[model samples]
Structures are given as C-alpha cells and as structure tokens.
Target: MLHRIARATTAAGLMVSLLTSFSARAIASEPPAHCRDIAIPVSIAQGQPARYRVWGQLCTPEHRPAATVQVLVSGLNYSHLYWDFPFRSSQYSYVRQANRAGYGTFNLDRIGIGRSSHPASAEVTLESNAYTIHQVVAALRGGAIAGRAFGTVMLVGHSYGSEIAKLEASAYRDVDALVLTGNAHTVSVSAQQNLAQLGQPVGQVPRLAAEVPPGDNGYATVQDAQRPEFMYNVADADPRVIALDIATKETNTLGELSTIGDADAPGVTALLRLPILIADGADDKLACAPDATDCSSAATLAAAEQPFYPHSPVDAVVIPRAGHAINLHRNAEMAYCTIINWANRALGTPPPSK
Candidate 1:
C-alpha cells in the first residue's frame, strides 16, 4: 500500500527474521500465484457499468480455506505491487509477513491505478472508488476469489486506501474490522508539497508525452530524485529500495487527490461504532500537521482521533523513527508485527506466537 510520505528528522527502520516469516505460515499448502489478474464488474451510482480487471495476489498459511481474509487496498499512485514489494521479498513485504502469520492477505490495485482499468480521472472519484472497494469485498465474501468463502473478512488500507476503506466501512457496514495505516485526521504542508512535485501528467514527461492517452492530464508520477523525499525516510532507507520505487512508480489522478480529504468529510459517518486502529509513524511529518507538528507521539495521535470516533474503541501505535512508509523502513517488521497482532485479535485467529 502507498502512503503519503512525511518529513522525518531522524531514521532507523523494515525488519525480517527468515525464521519468523516461515513460522508465521500456518497452512501447509504451497503459496498461490505470486499475483493474478481478475476482472471485477461494478456499477457506479449513475448505473454506469465498468469492469476493473484488477491485479491481485492472495497468500495464506494453510491449504484449506481461510476462515478470515484481509483485503488490502493501496493508497494513491500505487498498485497491488505496493503490498508484495519485490526488493526485500522477505524483508519489506507486508504480504510475506502477513501470510507467515496465518491470515490470508489479498492485495489489489485500486481501480484507476496500477494494472486496473483507468476510466478518465473524472470517473474515479472517492465515492466511485469506495463503491469499487465494496464490490471487491463482496466478491471475496461470495467466493469469487480463489473460490473459498471466508467466514470473516477484515479491510486493510494504507493512506488513501485507508480513507477509501473508511468510507466503505462507514456507509455499507460490510466489513468486520478495519486497519488504517499512514492516515490521520490532519495533513502537513510538506505532504502537500510532496504531492505537488509528483511530476506532470503522462504527456508532460519527456519519454511518455507522445504515446499516452489523448487527455490523460489528471494522472501524475513521482520525480526520480524526489521519490525518496516523497516516499522514503532518506536518512536510513535502502538505496536500492528507493530505486525500485522510482522505476516502478504509478500514477495518481487529480480526481482522487482532490477528493482524498473527504476521507474525513461529513458525507459518510465517522466510525464511532466500529473497531478501528490508527497507525502512523512517530516521525510522520504529514499526518502530524502542516508544520510536522501535533503527532509528537503515538498517544497523541490516538488521542487526536478520539473526537472523530467518540463511541468507537480505538487503539493507536506509532512506529519509532519511521516516516510515512512504515512498511518500507528498516524496522518494517515492527510495523508488520503490530498490524498482524492487531488483525489477529480482531479476526479471532490465534496470534502468530501461538
């Protein structure tokens, strides 16, 4: 999942013990396709039908059908590739770690980004994208994916994805729980700047200008050098990891960006009744505030969320020394472990230690 990168003053971080990963795998079956393609049919509020030939991959510890499944939605400008990062395979991949922990993880590209179909940026608004998420969850529950109906399904999202998941959970009440990462009620000016520098449209980039769609003016990509500045904690992130991100970068549409803040809009109910987790990096400059103020600690961030979810039980954690992309930091495992533990408890599955 892609998260809006925040400025961080210090760094040390993503983790993996090959053994810990192996032990987390509970099912005896071989892992399924590293990734697969599926087209999900969905109709928008306007009754317009469009097919999302989504790119997704699922992994579980056991061979039998998973009792609970986590449908992962990535943030803006990212695709399903965000979940199963190829760089560290074992080290930085949230998907690998989650499978080792025994819960099934299904990672998919959000509608207009990555391998999914792109209808003009105008068609990919927050509400439409939320509808896309709704259909994906329904498909999982109905056994359209991997042909194994899950007894329970949890929705996991990072940054923009988290916002989309929030909308779906609030409006449709279709999910059992939600794990929202790289998200907060507020955003920093630095974060906004990060969004601004994310390159011009496809036609504007030197190499892509000529062949791209006629009016693809709404999508943008991260500039090469700025890639780290936008998505990684430069002080400690692996150089190679940063390189892969820039080379494999995707596009973020203006429509999605303009409506992203609606993640907190009054359009949908604030989740005061659902079980939710608010996860952010201790050094996250963006979610903290415009000047990187506010989220000085995990407790502060959690407390900040209280007003928004007055009646909901909320628990928050801040990954130390990590920036916006906790999963990509050196201590990525800490982020992974925190989430897997929370998810296990929410889904009623045996903890990874068990």
Candidate 2:
C-alpha cells in the first residue's frame, strides 16, 4: 500500500516528492471523528483535570498491530501533528519508515493543547507535563505488549519536549534510548548568549544570573521564530503546539523551576551514560552555551560555549537556510536520517544500506 502510494505520488514529480517519498496510506485510514476529538480528563496530582487528545494512526510495520512503539515528545508549541499529523497523503512516509524499521509511533498532545481539555488560565509546566508523559509511558508499559515482544522503548523529543524526555528518563527506566533535537536546559550559558546575539534580550538575566536555566535563553530565542506547519494544521488552525510554545515562553519569562537541574548539570547532562544524540541547527539563533560553546578558535572566541551532554556527542550540523524548525525544513530529511541512523545503531538494528 505504501509503495503504491509512493509510486503514485512520485509519478506526480519532484514537487510532490517531499511528501510522497514517505508514502501516504498510513494516515489514509480515517480516524473516527470522535477519535480525532479526544477529551482525556487526567488528574494532575491535586490540580484540575488536565485535558488532552491522541490523534494519528498507531500501529506497527507490515500493516499489522505491533508492540514496540516510538513515543514522540513535542516541542513547546508544536503539537503531535508535527510528529504524526499528516497534511499531505505522503506525510505518512515518516511513520511508514519507522514501522518498516520495526517500531510503533505515538505522538503525544500535551495537556492544555490540541483536543485536550484546556484548564482555565492554567498553563502546562514541565513538572506537570512530565507527569502527563509518565502517565502515557506507564499506560504503554502496561499495554500488554510492552517490554515483551516490544522489547525496549525509545524516546524522541524536540525542544521543551526534550526536557520532558529527560524527566521521563529520570523517572522511567523502561526508556532504552533517547533522540533529542535542540535539547538544551535553562542553565546553559549558550542559551543566553545566543539570545543576545539574535537581538532578543531575556529580562530574567539580571536577577537570575546566578541560577537561570541553561537552555532558557536559547529556547526563548528559537521559539520566537514562527514555523508554518505548527501554525497551520488542517485539524486545528491553532494547533496546541502553538499553545505549548506560548505557555513555555510565558513560564520561562516568569522564571519558575521548570527544569530538572541542580548545581552541576541541567537535567540531561548525565545522559552520557545513556545512548543519546543531540542535534541542533547551527543557524538556530538559540544555539549557545549548554548546547554548544566556542572551540579553541579565534573566530569562535566570542560565541564559545561547551555542550552539556559531553557523553553523548552533539551533532551540531550547519543546516543552511534552516531555522528552529529543522525537522520540517527542506533538508529536514537529512536531519531525520541522521537521527534515525544513530537510533538504529543504538537499538542494534541498523537499516540495510542502499
């Protein structure tokens, strides 16, 4: 089915190749209107019931229902669609590739966004968001197919979603590997320096100078740049991703402890022990301190900062004409292909070379 869809769309020519190469049949199956409109009333500790929705097709390769799953953790404002929501028929190609590689995928819609119930004026915090992810992981773990034929689980998180992924790793041991993009913390100086270079100054710099989060500055700078797919999804004009991004920016501006850091490393510093990969666009205005520092070069002396996850080497690629939305950029396939290759090696299942 996927091959036929690819061939059909491919015949349309290169203009359609971007969406078609990935195949389109996976999302062709219509999710029940009700399925697309989920209202999960989840209780966050003693707080109000957090609402969220789960869209996109969840299945395995061979078009059969397999167990192993690829849970997607979204960025600050981007919703699950960036991960699974398919606009074009060919968008399903990403899923088909994952399935072909022997893994199922789940794109999470964090609370207060998407079809999820939106609490009145209550924004989603990292602690709150992490708890929500914990629930999802726990559910999948108990889903009768986890850790068995499913074997191990892998996590792929972008931006704020990467922060949550670190929290999930700290809280959940079932996660075997992590694939993080633009993953930085509140404390990293690189985040701050990058923000300044972009002509966007963070207000908290004066007060929280002693203990501001590593990636906060950089995250802030990156979020300001608008991306289209995140802004315009057919399902909802205002995708929860936009909401998440807004909520995260607001929270960061408020300077609450949304990070998982202490004196030394912000959350993911210790991930060196785990199989991890951190990739960020060189042109990303947010690329700084904890993400990358200046090497011993006269040129980089000004923008110099070392990476946080020293154990897991950061693949700081210079993606030309790319902004914060590296995944959806014209060269996004290159980035995804890199991460996928790394994941395959980490999972002991590298794909066959062409």
Candidate 3:
C-alpha cells in the first residue's frame, strides 16, 4: 500500500512557504512518516577547513527504524525536490515510495544549491561534492545525523549527481550500494545542445537572486523557458509539473558543469565493488541518442554500461516514455517501483508491504 498524507490546505501552504524561503530547515507533515531537517557539516575538500553545511530531509518509516538509508543527490539546477517533488507528491515523491517500502531517505541539497552554503561557483567541483558526500556517509554510519546509526547505506544520484555518487563510491568504497539515474557514460548530442543553452547567472534571474548569498557570482540557473526542453519529454509530462519545476529551480555552479564528466574516466567506476543500479528514461534525449547508449530497452542499456563496472553486479532499467527528469513524469511511479524493487533484491532487504 502507498503511504498517503492528508491533503490539508494549511499543510500545503506551509510546504510552499518553506520552499519559497529557502530555509535551512523545513518541517512538513506529509508522507505520513517521521521527518526532520538535518544539517551535516562538511568541507569542500577532505582535510580542508570545514566551511559548509549540506542540508537535507531525513524521513523514515513510522512504525520502526529503517535498517538501510538511501542518501539522495540531485543534478545541476535542482534541489532536494527532485527526489521528493511537491506537486501531486503522493504520486511523484520518491521519498514517500521509499518510506512505504521500509527504507529511509536523506534528500540533500548539494553545496552551492538551495538552503546549503553557497560558496564561490569556482570552488564547487565534482570532486569537492564527492568529498562532502563522503563526510555525510560517515555521519550516517557514526550515528551523528539522526541519532541512529544506519547499518546499511545506499548512495543514489541523478545526472551530474550520479557522477558525484560514482566518484564517492570509487574513492571511499563505504556505501553498500549505488543507484545512478539520468546518467550514462556517453553524452548525447541533444544533451550538449540543452546544456549549451540552459545556463545564465543566478543574479540575473529575479526569482533566484534572493535564494543565494549576495555577491556569489559562481552560480548559474536554467532559464524558465528552456527548462521544459532541458528536463522534460513534454508529451509525457504535465504542464503543472513543468511550471512548478521551473518556479522552484535552484542554482548549480560553473565549476560543476566544467568537471561533470570527470567521473566517466576509464577506471573510475571500475573501482566500485558494491552493487550498482543504472536507470534512465527511455525517451531521455540527454542520455539516449544515435551516438549515446542505446536506451531503447533495459537489456541494451545494461549491456552498454556493463563494461564500465566490470567487477560489480550492475542492473539497468529504462522507464518507457519518460524524459530526463523521470521522477517528475506522469509515469514516475513506475520508475520508483523499478528502483525500490531492485534495491530490495540486490540488498536482500524485503520491505514489509505497508
């Protein structure tokens, strides 16, 4: 059974306000779980001065503590909302689904994004983000975040976020499993086109100007008009989702975009021995093109990515008709089920049906 929260007007308003304010902490009574806002102190690079806090929401099942926790990371121009979307959240929220499946989720805003510290854009890179995430993993294991040590930790990421996850898993090898979505070893022509036209300085965008610290010129955001093309398969997406996505869009760094592909180096993923799941939307033009991985089917995608993780068990899935932001598509639930079911099987933790 799905976990559903009562749709109260006041509750909805509170959620909107929290997001609008870009508060470091937000509390929502949705998903019918035990939820709390968290701030884990981290540094841009290991052994460097600790200067930032990675903010996130930690949600767990109501009846019992979760044995495994999934740490979620979103792509560029996205916040934690990519994993726990607000509109029609019952249907679109991966956090709700994971909680129902008996797994806790920590949805984080990467450094330089919403509610987190906004360092100079030039200071945020894939390696720095990975180092910060490594600290977050240690906090989870050491019972520092929510006062409960999670025995099993799974790192999950989307698009550029996936690149960070791959780097963290390879460099630290601390996570028990890794889930990569909206990503692949090859970059598509459409992806290059979309990326080329999407970025603009955040300060120039009126809506995002107040979200970041003043004088932080290193951040960039996608223009509202270009978001649909950059993130959605319009035919398979709802107009409302697109509108909300654009309205709530966050900033990413120039440093990140320049080094986003660093994780795709020849032997980066080869170092991971943990179970890995690779998933992407079937219609994800950003990952599927004539020269990119053949995302026509799950089998083909699995075959294409197999060489990258030669030493680990790898599973791949293609959500039909969905686009790059699969979680926001009408068929998002299918993608959620695919991920949860795969995690259950791969990790050998069968969630008791709610």
Which model is ahead, 1 or 3, in terms of lDDT? 3
lDDT of 2 by residue, 1-354 (tens): 222122212211322332343333423342321112223345544465544433333455543444456778776545666564343313223454565545667655665445443332223466566666666665566653223345567778877677777766765556777776654343246544444344233334332222233444432222355333222221322344444433433223222123434212455444434665555544444543334433222123211212454444233233334445555444555555455555665677644322
**Stretches > 4 Å off in candidate 3:** 1-31
Judged by TM-score relative to the true structure, which candidate is superior, 1 or 3? 3
TM-score of each: 0.85, 0.59, 0.89
> What lDDT is obtained when candidate 3 is compared to the true structure?
0.82
Model 1, 36-62: lDDT tens digits are 456676665446655445556767665
RMSD of each: 5.8, 11.5, 9.5
Score candidate 2 by lDDT.
0.47
CA lDDT, every model vs. true structure: 0.69, 0.47, 0.82
Relative to the true structure, candidate 1 reaches a TM of 0.85
User: Which regions in candidate 2 have their CA more than 4 angstroms from the true location?
Assistant: 1-42, 46-57, 64-67, 85-93, 120-123, 144-149, 185-268, 288-321, 350-354
lDDT of 2 at 110: 61
- Best lDDT goes to which candidate? 3
Put the candidates in lDDT order, highest first. Answer: 3, 1, 2
For model 3, how many clashes? 0
